[model samples]
Target: MRTSLACGALMGMWLGTALAEDDVESVRARSNPAQGYCERVRGTSRAEAALEWAPEVFASVGAVNAGVAIGGNDDTPLGSPKMRVTAGLGYDFVGIYRGRTLRSRAEAECRRYQALAALQGALARGSRLGETEALQARARALAEALPQAETLVSSLREELRDGSATLEELNAVQVRLDQLRSLARDTEQARARLGLEPAVAEGQDLGALLTAFESADDQVEALAGGLRRARAWRVSLRGGYDEVFDEILDVDQDTPLFGQLTVGYNIGHLWQGKANAQAREGRRQETRDAVDSAPRQVRQLLGELRLTEQGEQQRLREVSTLVSDLEGQLREVEQLETRQVRRFRDYLLLELARLKAEQAYLGAHLKTLQSLLGGVKS
Candidate 1:
């Protein structure tokens, strides 16, 4: 449910825009967890006002040699030296018959705004995602280190019980393990605040993200259509009814209704249409290029992401092998007649090194994931 980013820890950290707190059930929630983009994209709309006509007035007078009034019978006044007067008042105005074209222009503007919002919102979310994932990686690293620290503390405690290790050394080891645990807990809580505690579902990865790129290509076609419609000129038509008030006719016969029709072309509007068509072509091409390049760029990013993950896997394997070797050396030292605490210290350091390596690799992998879906081209 895309609403506001006010609740997330990442809010106000990436971009100035924030999301609302409303949550809804939809596919949109998968891509926009904070709902910031969805709320902003909804601003595109159209507005309309009531129609009004320009006013026109007409007056005419003539010596009547028995002119028949409207709705007059044959017995009506005829052959009389009478002065006839008729005054017609009407409302008229030149209208460009391009209402559809005007609407198209409005819609085009709306889509452009939506595209801009999409781009900016994606960038903001991507930056936030990167930051949150980094926190999570740190938390995981501390978690791994905590257990190693605890194991070392337990071994020292046993030596203290055997009178081989001093209480001060055991207490120091316990304190280090407790510090690691406290740091890990704080990191996890920070990650949770950022909404990164429960990772995204597996299904919403590269496959779903690529589908979004295809959808963008479809929007280009719609934008082209909107631009074409926006460039068209509207034809003007003026038609209305006018009631005539005849002072002479009222004395002779009852006044009647008269209808007026006007037809005209707007050359200036047509010329403007030509200019608009040319201007709109440039926008059409720009939008098309933006949309067309999105999919290819996403595909390339996906490849980069895969490579990053593969590299991380290899590093994890090498680090794990080194940790295993160090453990085996510690065991060999334990079986030796000579007691050397150096071997145990080396094993602890090796474990810590392995944990740090895991942390680094996982952080890199998280950044790659963020790039894949965060709408960042690079």
Candidate 2:
């Protein structure tokens, strides 16, 4: 079992916002690992990490209302009292509706954030499936070709390190590595355009990753050389040499070349064999640990999402049922407007209310299915 939702590493500021807002949407947004949630991606995320920041829709409403109450005036006579009350409340003024838009703004941010995450997860799952097919294809092409390619790449790298690999081979591998890097970068940009953050690569380009892999492979190879008088000893010498040149010009070109020597020894007998065996087993162990973790974490996220889905589904059902109830209530409001023309604006506002209820109901229920599958098309 993994840890609880409270301690996953992205909840501090979100929690603060939660306490500050303390509303329904706030509760929904702050439920799980919304940060580092991009770890679900194959790479690091390239999106704005602000849903975890001081995310609220309106900052001035409270202050404005506080001021209006303090001053005892309908300062917002031109607009809604709610607007006049929060206008000068001391916050970053964005536009005309800044004071009145906090709640709506916060909800929008939350929706955008969840949408970004879902897109990333969907893209990654698709990419992973593609990689699976590619791996299978590679396997078929390797009829004993696996070990052969490994040896070819290894010997080629060894030659390169020893200043013996031909330019052609080095250039070819370098090109391949560059191409992979370009592909990764392009994938990240595509995600970003979709409002998802770019996932960062843990290591460098393909060249760097391959080089590191080769270095490790070399170590593993040397280790597996087994119990024997391995000639893997490295020797360095330090000395001075003198040479004379033109005596006619009296140019004594006698410069000494001095350096140092270093030697290393390993009882290749047990050490090599043990290291080789352990390296293979250790790699498999690490992979097993990772594989075990992936779907578990994915499912956990999915479960949290499912609960939200159920709750939203319930909420939508209630809203729709209320919609039916509101149909009669709406006619009453209209009838009152006919008797009292002054009630026209309020009657229309009620109509908007009913519309919003229906719209929200549909969105909530639709999200249930969307969040469960972890796919939302923008």
Best by TM-score: 1
* lDDT agreement with native, every candidate: 0.48, 0.38
Alpha-carbon RMSD, each predicted model: 11.2, 42.1
Per-candidate TM-score against the hidden true structure = 0.46, 0.25
* Tens-place lDDT digits, model 2, residues 171-209: 554454333334333433332232222332211122232
Model 1: number of backbone collisions: 8
Off by over 4 Å in 1: 1-45, 49-118, 121-131, 137-155, 166-241, 251-264, 267-274, 281-378
lDDT tens digits, residue span 1-378, model 1? 111221232233222211311221233456553344434433322222112223445676666565454456867655455565656665433222223334444444444444444433333343233344566466556545544555566666678799877776666555655555555556545544545222333213444454544445344445445444433433233233323334555543333445556554445554665655665566555543565554444455455555665666677677667667766666766666533464356345535544564555465555646545454343
Going through the candidates in the order shown, the clash numbers are: 8, 13
Query: Local error of candidate 2 at 18, Å?
Result: 29
